[model samples]
Target: MRFDYSEFSGDQGFLSPDELFAPPNLMNFILQYGEQAMDAMANLEDEEEQAFIQQLIDAGLLEESTDEDGNRRLKMSPRLLRGLQHRALLEVFAEMKQGAKEGHSTREPGRTSERSDGTRPYRFGDPIGELDLPGSLQNAARRQVHRAVEEAREAGVEVPRGLRLPIGITPEDFQLHNTEGSADCATVMLIDLSGSMMRYGRFLQAKRVALGMSELIRGRFPLDTLQFVGFSSLAETLHERDLPLVMPKPVSIRDSQVRLRIPLEQAYANQEKIPLHFTNLQLGLRQARQILSRSGAANKQIFIVTDGQPTAHVTTHPATREDMLYLVYPPSDESSELTLREALRCQQRGIRIASFALMEDYWGMDWVGFIEKLTRLTRGTAFYCTSEDLASTVVESYLTGKKSKKFIH
Candidate 1:
């Protein structure tokens, strides 16, 4: 018996260039199918769809640009990108009223000007001013009493019910005035680029969320840093401007079980040799941790949007003590273990983790369990939802984390 294979071809002949779903609309069509929208537009001839192109020009959202091949193509203005980004977030806010009871709507941030009743614990780089003397003394007194009670118990002595005043304040007990929006944050958003994400329009929702988050951080949380890391067989940093063009890697290999170890240097040199559809969350979290370490923000957090458990991870080769990619299929326990270890490392660095698990599959139990274990180990939050719930869930997580960060430091 002989097997034959040839270059795969897509059936685009029936698809017309003017048969576009989204014509620069910020809502359902463009945000969900940006690549198709662009491709459809690019395929049209110069004289074709003149009215539609004119409309885009009239709206000041479209411009002309030359491709690498020196051919002219339609380009979207920064204004259009800004509009799409802002609209994504606005849609989330709009969903808040409808989905708050779903356990995703967080306490809205910027609720009040200042917290007069309490003082938050001081962090290393907090602004120094009138220290909350009462709050400081209270923390000091609590610590002292706790130590005293422990000592008394160990020595079999009765503890004094009343404690003395004039509690000396230590650095640990120092508290800063609680302000509504005082703390700066560094946020890393890890988006799954696994092949599983290609189903049920999952990647579209993820892209929309990333864009919204990028804009939300830029416009609302100016001091906060937002990084998007996409993970598959490898992890790579994604920028906001290039997000729309990004898509989940199509499954390139089909095997019941797979195991491969590729040298990191070699993989980087010739990336086309390796498959890019397996989830490698350990590398994603590691990238996020490194990016956050460089940020000067007082509060750091990671938001992971993924649809499946990790199937691949990177490990340092014992002999070389250098980076290497460990790929596996059927989601080996080893892969999950390595990913969870990285999550733990993130938590140990005072970074909060929030996992948004997209459960569109009936066979989602394995991934949900992994998410549960991750949250447990990191002392973080987990949200189980579908792609439809992603916008509100992401918004709630972002707002919830932002407001609650006041207590973290």
Candidate 2:
């Protein structure tokens, strides 16, 4: 059941020795291609590679089965999935190590004046006193030289020998010394489990982000709390132990008709029969608020990772026996307003809402407006990014929020 380290120590055709052992790459491939990952492995001509695949099966890392159509498929075992989550967390830690050093201090501008060895692009409102004069000047010089070269190329004029460009010290060229600080914080990651997220593979990306953030908080800020909430037709709190096992349900044409007829509670009760397919953002925010209300941390923040507009909300009606719950769809203005109200409530509670709009460009103006307003109302930030950058973006946002005292109420 154990993997032979020596077999993977040597190169195997298209994959290098290191890649064969890299859990993140292997997990990503399997998540994206499913059975194809195993098929590719099985197709390998090398006996060592074949044995390696067999070991994965023997170790319960992978399960080979047939679908309803009798086609062979490979599924990742729970143990292997958990290992992948750990691997993803490690990758984030590795990225943090390569970036700025971690430590604790007051992020207030006037409270702490000491500067670290690192420098970052100067942000508006950063105290001028914190500026790194030498680094800023160098940045300005580089910009000026690049501009001069472009001007010469446009004019069809050869650069004069020994030409010296004057350094322009614009604010845009300023650089500030990086600072590190820490604060007690409670963060809830609201992941969109709607059909669209699964359709585009964004759900998997978000899952990895959650795992990475969980690890970051657990390792770096031991006292801080990080909660994960997944929202589709309804919002549910997910424990860290169950995170690796979560999978998005595929959306079929009949999903819309079937999900709308069922109550949210009933759907949840029969989750295996009726999978979540609609985006219920309002429910997610409400749950986040409830979770954060119990936390004593000075800083409370909500990080939303979504790929589409809010398309559903919860409503109740009195029935003959009891009150019935329903999921309202088409993302009406009421739903949008309710979602905003929840965000405003969070703000009033001193909770900052930072949203990462994955695939925003592909979803059009409605998605853009929703995310922009959510962040603006809460006085938080919004980032539009691709799936490839989601993990790094989530980690950076969390770290920045922790270091900056402004996010604290």
Best by lDDT: 1
Candidate 1: lDDT over CA atoms? 0.76
Q: For candidate 1, report its TM-score.
A: 0.72
Clashing pairs in 2: 105-181
Residue-pair clashes per candidate: 0, 1
lDDT of 2 by residue, 124-200 (tens): 77778778899888888777778788888999998644437565589988988776444678889998877777655
Q: Report model 2's TM-score to 2 decimal places.
A: 0.62
TM per prediction: 0.72, 0.62
Clashing pairs in 1: none
For model 2, the superposed segments whose C-alpha errors exceed 4 Å read 1-26, 33-82, 90-105, 109-181, 254-262, 272-275, 318-329, 360-363, 402-409
lDDT of 1 by residue, 246-315 (tens): 8888799999989999988887687788998999899999999999999888788999989889999888
